[model samples]
Target: MSIREMSKKIVLCFLLTSCTYSINAQVKDSLSFIKSKKMSDDDLLKKREGTFATGLPDFSSDPVTGFGFGIRSNFYWNGERTNPLFAYTPYLAKLKANVAYYTSNARELILSLDVPYYKGTRWRFKIDFKAQQNPANLYFGSTESTVGNLRLPSDENTTFSTYAAFDKARKTLRPGGVGEAAFVTDALSNRFRETEYMLNLKADYALGNGKWRIMSGYEIQHLSYKTFEGEEADAINPITGEETSAPNGFSLLQRDYDQGKISGLEGGWISILQTALIFDTRDFEPDPTKGYYFEIANEYSSKYIGSQFDFNKLFIQARAYQKLPFGKRTVIAGRLGIGNIFGKNAPFFEFQDQWSPEGSINSLGGKQSLRGYRANRFLARSLWFTNVELRYRIAETKLGKQRFAFGVAPFFDAGTVRDEWQNLNFKNIKYSYGLGARVAWNQSTIISFDYGISKEDKLFYVGIGQAF
Candidate 1:
């Protein structure tokens, strides 16, 4: 059936099932999920009945002295056949909490934390915990992992080789996933449990004509795995033209057969010192809807003790926007930036190589780049990206005295992954284009959906705005 038809059926089922509920409960569960262009993590936590909290002062009532608090617990899952690379491992749950507050004086702070737990398909409980404070200039929080945020490298050959090896080993050991075999495979042995933490501080100091902002932080991680992923030698019966199988049905004879075994505690700490220079040329004070924002930041980090990675990076992003053709409503904006993950020699980590294109901007899906693919689908040493957008305001209204606004935009994005600094090529860059819809809960929060397209893929992405 068409998506519209499917949507109609879902709405019909929901209405028929809960037509008699109270307005608050109905809105919290059904209406919020359907009416909102995009659902927030906070909403998901509430649905799951977990504790959720926000440190931002409240501005819902009189705006100046208001404070708000919220808590919820929710779990998300994806099965293998649905999303190959992601589901190929196991279906896991994420326990999350979020809280935020904003004062009348314009100071705002938000806290969001996530803890991974439970194993849906595999026997191991592979969990990861992450917490971050937005507007880092305002509060403190953890640094996010590059795993999901950064894109990785990709080549058809490399993709086939790595995944094919994994698949072949899985089929040989599990053989159609029967009983115990279903829970045991080369894929399952590689699973591990890890914890990551970061503390971020961002603040702005205003002078007579412009604003000066500073962002600094530190991060640490602890990875403990029962067994690292490795294959055993393939056992073959030379006399019978057949392969030898072990008691567990694994191919017993193969080269470099490394069995997955629980390794002791392996952890590390990484700290970064960061500072940024910003030039703000606008009419308004601390907050202005229309203005030019420019930033150049330099961050340095030492190797993680008892870990295998080290790097220093320089990040820069600049933005400009101006009123456009349509009435007083439409606006056009553009952003350009360069980001590099550089190291003296090879990386300390084992999974990705410096030239690997798995999680850099050159990869398929990522923030400010492609929306059709998952973030960090590809990785690489260094990357570059550029974007432009045209937006039009659609509507403005108040919901029971709560103000909300909506808008639509068309955007073009370009980026790439590269090995050495000298290997960069902008003329042969990869690009994507899409249309987006955005809704503002208040001035501080907005949710967006982008229906993006590339020559080989088309995707509908939902997240917070803007892409940059």
Candidate 2:
């Protein structure tokens, strides 16, 4: 179905469901989740008991992915407040499930589970399963090569001026022939379809004093890629003012494969063994008010481990949160991270992903990273980034047994990529600034909306939990 038709149906479904539930309970309480106040660790743990659940319509839009619709549900079981682990973990047990589809032929199904102090021991366990596909994933080349006048206009101009300029450049490079140089100028060169299936299992055992942990995990992942098929609608050829057929994918990825710039275009298995050292002192896992979190994670993929390719990845990250004494319910949070990949046999798809003890952070330009740019807008073997936010809670209220708090955060983000460590420089560092609105539901779930602007793009995002 067309995007418009699908959107209409989704809206109708949401309205019907909302009406059916709203009449039976307060609309706000039924739709939103919980909140908490600053308290001593013992006091905070004492108040969390019983079970809490919340489910919401996952309606969102993105510049590259178009409109998305789905459902997200979170279930939390805190057990009795008297449980010893209550003082050490966010929840005794939790489960999250999400299913979403985007207009750009991108879709995802994810199921995750977390249990801290499992079986009343110091061990914590986590499992995550995901299946996802994206037919229009972005790929703007790597490192310094990605910078230049390679971008097409975001909007068509009067008299097709931008197209006229782009076509002129294409002709200058190829002299009537569409070679690699000329092809790279086309917007279509930046997209290729990919499907990924992943399963992750992890365990962490708390050490003395419960402030340090040893983490280990394993992941099974498979990926495949293809060029888009079928023809697109015709568009005006600015040079001749005549219509020209718009072709589908078959862009940069195909060109790279044919030229041997990369390998494993058909994709294969990538089994990874991971380990990390973690130091955490955050007062709360979901919304930290004062503390620090640090991790140095290493991942290895080898033929002996059943991986089709061989490579090693290292990621280091540090985060801090401090509640301001001068402002009511205010906190300052910051994160710094750096990562690199070793070995010549790593698949191209592996370059854009960052892994840690918590989970995977895909690319440096998306809701989780650059914010203002499209996902995977930049790619390379080495990357570094930083994020800072000033968050202030503005309101709080209770509806029946459910508690909620509203907050706003102003944030700054900066990052860069390089093909190798030797090529890294301070020049051409991409940065963006933005503001975010947050809704704290119960104690663990946070609904977030953010809008960011950079020199190249303006984008908005809506999701669960903080960007970090």
Candidate 3:
């Protein structure tokens, strides 16, 4: 229950349900409810008028269908801190739903449901699925902690350690066995225990007229755990402190009561067969103030084979956006990428390359990248990532029948972890920056919030749609 204590319990549940009711029966005096709901509030203050005489019709002359279902639940705690960067405090309650059907011949049909209840667990059904096509041409999902939550951050510089810096780095890498000790048997405790499950599938296509396009998918993960098993405690080296001797006499650190059970299952299957060459003249989606949306995406991934981890990659990701005419619906975006992630036996605590000796910040947070970081924190062979965002459109609503929108965004993220391809560029990058929000009711479901910061740490995100 962090995030400033769940934002002070969502502002004390919106000030106890908006201050115990009745500001004249739930506050309704918008010019007497727009003249008793007769509508036409001066054509909503005439925004260049044109809705066919305000009676409002012409739903684009056709096409309109959407269905939805949702639930999100989480209760958290990350106590036990000795300032190892504010140790422990991760809590959650998630509920989800989907029922979508769209037509204009572009076709689409989706049916989904998910329910999760942590802490004492018992809510079941994580996702039920079905699909058909084109619901805005891509950006369909199954939520991976809303997109990877191994706890975030990248380019390995390491942080988030307390419990006495992981009990003084497991007593300086395994000392005098009491079961080898790792996050316990000394300095501070609470090693590990985790549970996970995931599923995903998506599709995309838009050639020529779209300049070019092709996207694909497949994803899965199942992880059950118990951790910390070390080796090397036969010490005797001062300055160099080099001591070896852990052929299994002890050094199994944690996980050896019933020798910890179910400990493997990791999945990955992503296809971004790309082609993009957009030169948006700008009618929308390029708002800083007015225009800029030039895109180039040639991306690919194929080395995350499954259960216990596996990777084989190919990369190229690039993007850019603009719209900053001086506030009032602002916009600015950026993205860049280069990749090559390989694997063999995997499993170094889920493919470790760096970060996880107490580290985490923003490796785009899993499943395919940043929805608030945490999932596969750099298990490398090669990688490079970059991102930037700034969007604004604070408020607009008409509630009663529909039409509502709200927005806010601020972002900057970075990634790096290399071993080849000339050790990838950007001179070993690592970064983080954050703030996000959105509500878009009329557009049919969009509720998201993101908060990220670094100087140490800060990450808060709630989700439903649009982080892409």
lDDT on C-alpha atoms for all candidate structures = 0.40, 0.71, 0.37
- Give candidate 1's TM-score: 0.51
Judged by lDDT, which candidate is best? 2
Residue 167 miss distance in model 2 (angstroms)? 14
Score every model by TM-score: 0.51, 0.81, 0.25
User: Which window of ten consecutive residues has the lowest lDDT sum in model 1?
Assistant: 134-143
User: What's the CA error at residue 293 for candidate 2, in Å?
Assistant: 0.8
Best by TM-score: 2
Q: Write the per-residue lDDT of candidate 1 for residues 1-468, one digit (tens) a residue.
A: 999999758744532332222334433432221121222232222121211111222224321123433332222232223222121111222222343343422232233222111121111122223442211110000111121221111111222223334334433433323322332333323222233354433333333322333333333443322222233323333345455442232221111122321112243554555556655443221112345667776655565433344566665667776666665357677777666566653232211211111011223244446555434433345556678878777887766534566888899987665555456577446677889887754422456679877653577765543664
lDDT of 2: 0.71
Question: Compared with the true structure, what per-residue lDDT tens digits does model 2 show for residues 1-468?
Answer: 999999758744543332222122353232121112123453373344767777789887754467999999887776554444445457767779899999987999999878765655567888899999877677655444553434432222312223245434322211112332221223344567789899999999877666688999999999998763223522346457554544432355666677776666789898999999998877778888888889999999999999998899999999999888865579999998888989876777877778887667866788888877667776788888889999999987777767778999999998888888677667678888899999988767889999987776778888888887
Report the C-alpha lDDT of model 3 over 224-325, residue by residue, as the tens digit.
Answer: 443323422232233466643332222122332234421122223222222333333222221222333344433233343323344444445555555667
374: Cα error in model 3, Å: 23
Residue 239, model 2: lDDT of: 58
Runs in model 3 deviating more than 4 A are: 1-111, 118-125, 128-342, 345-381, 384-393, 401-403, 408-425, 428-439, 442-444, 447-464
